[model samples]
Target: MATTETAPRRPLDAGPPPLVADPAALRAVLDGPHAAVRDEVRDRLADQSAILDESADLTRAELRERVRDLVVEFGAQGHAALGFPPEVGGGGDIGASVAAFETLGYGDLSVLVKSGVQFGLFGGAVLQLGTRRHHDAYLADIVAGRLLGCFAMTETGHGSNVQELRTVARYDAGTDEIVVTTPDDSARKDYIGGAARDGELAVVFAQLEVAGERHGVHAVLVPIRADGEVLPGVRVEDCGAKIGLEGVDNGRLWFDDVRVPRGNLLDRFAEIGDDGAYRSSIDNPDRRFFTMLGTLVQGRVSVGGAGLSASKVALEIAVRYGLRRRQFEAGTPGEETLLLDYGMHQRRLLPLLARTYALSCAQQEVTRQLHEVFSQDTPDADERARRSLESRAAGTKAVLTWHASETIQECREACGGAGYLSANRFAALKADTDVFTTFEGDNHVLLQLVAKGLLTDYSSEFEDLDQFGMVRFVTGLAVETVIERTAAHQLFERIRDVLPGGRDGWDQEAGLLDPDYQLAMLRFREEHQLAGAARRLKAGVDAGTPSGQVFREVQDHVITAARSHVERLVLESFVARVRALPASPTRDVLTALSDLYALSTIEADRGWFLEHGRLSAPRSKAITREVSALLRRVRPVAGELVAAFGIPPEALGAHDLVGPPPADISG
Candidate 1:
């Protein structure tokens, strides 16, 4: 039902005019019908900004006072408890929690990460994986901020390699207790929030050893502090000054054979009996490990949401600055051009703007899927639930976290030199966001996990395809890949064949940009991923490698393939949304955004298309030209696009460039 459309004939000297769309229109596209939610988040952010402004130059004690003041406000309003269980004193909706937390992006990254450590990480781990007993015992105090909690998972030596952690929880049957200990300095829990100050309890993760057989990682409740003093056998040391998030007292925690009741274990998947015996509902150790890890996928989802917010803030600052900042004059005498008017500037920022939108849409989809699994029962079996959760968790976490890092850096650069200044927020945001890539599992490692999941799915779903079916799928894939590689060449060739083009022919060719072509290009990328995976797997097989090593190699290929597939899917979703819109200036703006996304992807991976003989040299050139042109068109809408993310001034704090008028300077 779908087919590629070629550009129409055109005259030599004419091309499509540059795009222009206002900030308000861009905001409408991002907020959609969820304007009220955006507004609420904006108001909260504004309040936070006010606090930052008030304490801009305070002492360490004064700063802590300000942080405590803000924490009190956040605690009193129950804003920090958005994503917890309703039964355990939470909002009961993961989506709502993420949405509200994202607004925190407009404020300080330090505040956002600190708050995330409290609610999303510490509180979330317990609520998602712990039983009702654990919930009743600890969730209320955590939610109310009466007892701050820290998530102790990452050790000094083992970061992404969580399965190899050295921290141990050996059950002591004589005392009906579990002896939790740090075997060496490398085994100490490093970089734990709330551990340095404020936290009374910790959700400690360690190797579960019962009856002498070691099980995989599991979580347990360990009290590290009470009555404003450190508990016996626990050593907490400040992490000291860092790049950013100074307000958070992130620190290292060492447990010196601390003993707690065996019941302290938060066992939803794996448990310890009264006699110090270990039992698990899961049979497969690997599956059980993933099941436990998947329970905490909310951290990734929240990070994604937070990343989007960070990108949005950076864009807002850049766009606002771009609109007001002037540079060399062009087109009109003595009138300096807006920074956004420069093609190079647009090239740097507009495509990223489109990407932010794509990321936002993808984030919402991930959040929605998470809510479905957590809140409602699906028709599939329990194993299916586990697999689905694992896949989504891996995919979303990989995509969103990477996007956040990339987008923030791009935004920082886009703001020219001002972006690097601490006063501008970019530098601070960059510092705080740097650890996101490493935390909640490293980006590359998470992507490999997604890859493994994809391979498993592919083997399960398509391993039995008949020869004819296999042939058809491969043929379809190859054809799509060829088309993508040659799209620019194909467009230019078709146009030149019909009408010897100058600017007019180029303009007509540009009109050939349609939803069907976009869809086809997307399909081509997906096929390329599959083909690449197949090639890698075949290479490994031909080398006579061990099955496990070969499988790992195959997994890396599959994850890269899966990531490409998901990226295309996201672009297609953005294009679909654009097509569904009524014809307007806003629609035109969205169209440019969609094009930027698609073309940039194609540009990034032109090699595959070229090697596969999908495109000719002329077509490749055309793609580059078209991409540059689209960037130029989207430049005018850059400010509007970021503004659509809907962050409020207060949450951004004193660092925000756009804030309310000072009381002393009355209008």
Candidate 2:
């Protein structure tokens, strides 16, 4: 975890040109193709700015109602229809919808969570999992906020293992109905958003049975509440106050033989016919289950985008405050220095600023892929493409959310005690985003999924998610651990192919700042880790070691390989984004930031690089020096970098945290 020192070993390089960049140009790049959506959301948030300030003062019940009201307002305004199909009264722009969701992160996170629950998760489930009949019956009302709902998939006994969920939906041929029931307390749906108070219906995932044949898990619509009353045969309980997101009505639910018409089943992927036989086009239960879940990958993509936006909010607040707040004097006699003037403070916040930019590029790419996959006519043919998208989404979500948690906490510490105060916003930012790492999918499990996909090269249908299947599959493969190139691959290849004498030239200090060099180092680590993990699995399997024990032994390696792969993708995305910008101070500034992000990440993991023989002892230390030097170059533009996030002043109230302005030190 050691990072660059505040003081560098040598004099600072002049680095990029002066800080003459336009914040608008930088904002446009960060906003990607959906710049209009971001701007619209910002304007909407500005009009309701008071909620961001007043949320902390409201009681739990009051806050819940306030968030609910705002969601309804958004729905009534047609904002919630952005992600749905055009035929269903929607704007039919999937990427724009995600962009809007990301912008929502600037406001109260409780409201963000509630909005995500309704539009992103619950509504997404109905749209993606349900067939034409189901969509016609529910889509318009759901989009208009007339029909509230919950995506009740996770049970107490089974969350990550969705295939093993115990809740059951049995089709009764005699009654022509589907009976849903929670077989045990553990089978009860827990942590269901909107279940405690507002949800009128639940899209419940349960094992489907017809004529003694079980057809894996499928979604069935069951009424949970009516006329503000808990419906018959359904039980609900409040999850009470938590560390954060108090505005979201998280709850638990139990169903006691709840019956609905057979047509209530979301039969897009599977169905029961008039003959009372379970049927699905996908023969394998595992393939069908994954396909069903893959359709809902938008939830993961939205969470990652929201997490990135939160990081932007935190960085903007901390950087601006650092620019204004001053402490002990260092340069002038009796003149207090700005907090950002010190090398230590710059090292702390500037690199994080750089990383936020990198993640913005990656998030935009993921959102673009999400839109492409969902907009197609034959979405089922999108199986391979969807799997790839899902893998990247999973990896990106893990990294982005983890970065949000880390960046917010660091920003809080950088601002000193003022950040701890309720009015400053860090407390809320930290508390609300802490659960992001686990909610959509646990970070560890998600990363392992990314690694698993990489290992199989997406050849298998992902029939077995267990450790045994992973080791067995890996051992069976003729492993190809090649590094996939980024969109800027040719340029990277030119730089790499021209390097003098490979390792000898790679060890030079100048190469430390090169984009190609940074990418090579990251790719090298990822490829090495992946190959090593494959070898270890093969070894264990060859020796007839139990699959569980073999997997446990290599679990750390598996996760590391996944993390390394994601870091490489993030850097590549940043580089490609920079290449897209025209030659100007804006491009120069972004290039410098891309360098900082790459080097800082390399520096943080220097030990791993060193242990793997990828970096010589002296070369490893040079990366630290390069990071410190980049920090000095970036220090002048720290304020400008954060401002480009274009967060409305009303949304980031931390301007009030610095008290009165102190003496300027930049001059």
Candidate 3:
């Protein structure tokens, strides 16, 4: 049999270099390789036309109304119970629940989040952490939406620190009851969804004391109200009016010696026996705490998906506005230039577009990992399961929430004064998303958790090394750090010596710009952060401090390192994605996008480079010039880039038609 020979696959070509590079030089690299992952995402998006369209037109008020309707509809249809076990009328696939839930992000973040709270948060907590008995008795009503519930873990005093919460659940063995009380004003469960008016049940988190031994934090099912009346000893207070998400009715709850049956305790992870004895499958207190927390990782994953959706919306709005809105018209009378034609505008927006793209890829990876762990087919080891969940939760949560905030703000600025208008959507989107940074674990605190995980990994590696091996490892790290710092300093100095002054200087240096310089600079920052952390750890050891406190201090440094690492990874991913595209008129535009992303990152962290002697003043100037140049080069393709987001016209809805075409010159 004769075998057919095939041509080698070529990467997608990004079109012409922005005014900065020689067209010949640009053409040479046009046939570079493409990432299969991008194609998969593109194809996935292609199949979801209707969902994307609905996502685009979704507004805050409409979202609120529709969400309320969904709550009622799901309740009536019993659709809310889809993710639970078969015995309790659920599909028994938690991964499917998350997958379907993530798709809702394409609709509107507010709607997705509210739905998440109803199904994933409120209903999910009861299903996963609650016992089979609890599921049979209370899960049905909660899932059907007959009873709205809230996951009450956060308090005014202790936000990310769940263990420090003051809500107490003292078991009264004589009465066969537990008194759940919020001891002080700060201890009240604050900012709980469904607490204000809708919720009839709450998975209240509080310190559990069985036979006088405090058992850290545990979940208990509490009846908050019946028939619109607050239950005895339960106080419900509305957290009225906020910067954003006003429709969801977030509120505070105070428990004053609230008497709940001992059986109401959702003790799947940590149990309290009928005889007032506390027992747990997890021996380590810390492990138990994390395992319980990990069960709720779905919220973080959903938040990430939501954040990515929001970023897409913002980018679409800004890019559309850029293509339509006119600015300086040089020679033609009454003929305004498209906002995107301006180099500055591209500089401001395109990299954020790149970031949104990168974040989407990361979110998909996180979702996949989450699905794997939750999948029944996979052999689940307890430790590996916890790490997988925690890693996805912490990493994606930090990345996506931060991306939402930054991208929204950038999109707002991209649209200029119009972006400030409420009707334009930027301002409202920003306000609504602002809370995302703190919710589902504050970004800083979440980063700290990520940092702790890294330290643990590092410590484990440290344990395997002998004394000489340890010394060699430290030496290798130091050498790499020194070499990176030196190389950066030299490159920056060389660029400064060659490049001219002012805008003209920037234009010339732009041609000489190498993307690798930025990557190198970032690497230096990572090394610096790592070295600083090591120094701190050493100091703590010398002081003979408690291991736990020492670990916490080291963890803070690790968070800084992790952030740097994440940023670097994003830049690398963006470049890799760009390199994989097929050659077309749009290829050069994509390359410019890659450049814009890399340079913007460097520009954003100019201080790091400057502080570590990685970048000289001249090279920094070149970075600004090159980024602006790339932005201008990619301007004409902004529409195509947003279009490639593959959002359906329905999701874009009226917003898709709100603006005129870029080529429409009737002024």
- Which candidate number has the best TM-score? 2
**Where does model 2 exceed 4 Å of error?**
1-16, 463-465, 478-497, 500-504, 658-667
lDDT for each candidate structure: 0.69, 0.86, 0.66
Candidate 3 — worst ten consecutive residues by lDDT sum? 27-36
Query: Candidate 1, 121: how far from true, in Å?
Result: 1.2
Instruction: Write the residue-wise lDDT of candidate 3 on 1-667 in tens digits.
Output: 3222211222224433333223232323221122222233234334433432343366634544555665555455544455677786776655455555544454444545666788888887887688778888877776666667788889999987787789999999989898999999999999998788677888999999888888888889899989978899999888867787665757899999999998888887888786778889877665577667777787888777677777877887888877777777757998888777776677678888866766655665566567667654422354555575576477678888898898889888877777776655665578778888887888877776554444344343332332223333433354445335435445544554444353244334433334454455565576567666656655665677655576565666667876876676666655554545554444445455566767787788888778877567887887777667666656555666666654544444335323644453211
Q: Residue 643 deviation, candidate 3, in Å?
A: 2.5
Better of 1 and 3 by lDDT: 1
Model 1 is weakest, by summed lDDT over 10 consecutive residues, at 658-667
Put down candidate 2 lDDT per residue, 1-667, tens digits, no spaces: 3222211222236444465657789899999898998888899888877887888788888988998999888888788899998898999999989999999899888878988899888899889888898889999999988898998999999999888999999999999999999999999999999999899989999999887778889999999998999999999999998999988999999999999999999888888888877788888888889888999999999999889999998988888788887799777899898888788999889999999999999998988889999889856666678888999999999999999999999999998998988888898999999999998999999999899887777776464466578888888865443233232234445566655446456667867766778888887788778888988998888999989999999999999999999999999999988876666678778888998999999999999888977678998888888788778888887777777888888888765674433343232
The RMSD (Cα, Å) of candidate 3 is 8.2
lDDT of 1 by residue, 153-257 (tens): 999999887778899998888888999999999999999988888778899999988878889888888999999799999999989877767777788999999
Give the best candidate by lDDT.
2
* TM-score per model over all chains: 0.84, 0.94, 0.77
Q: What is the C-alpha RMSD of each candidate to the true structure, in Å?
A: 6.6, 4.6, 8.2
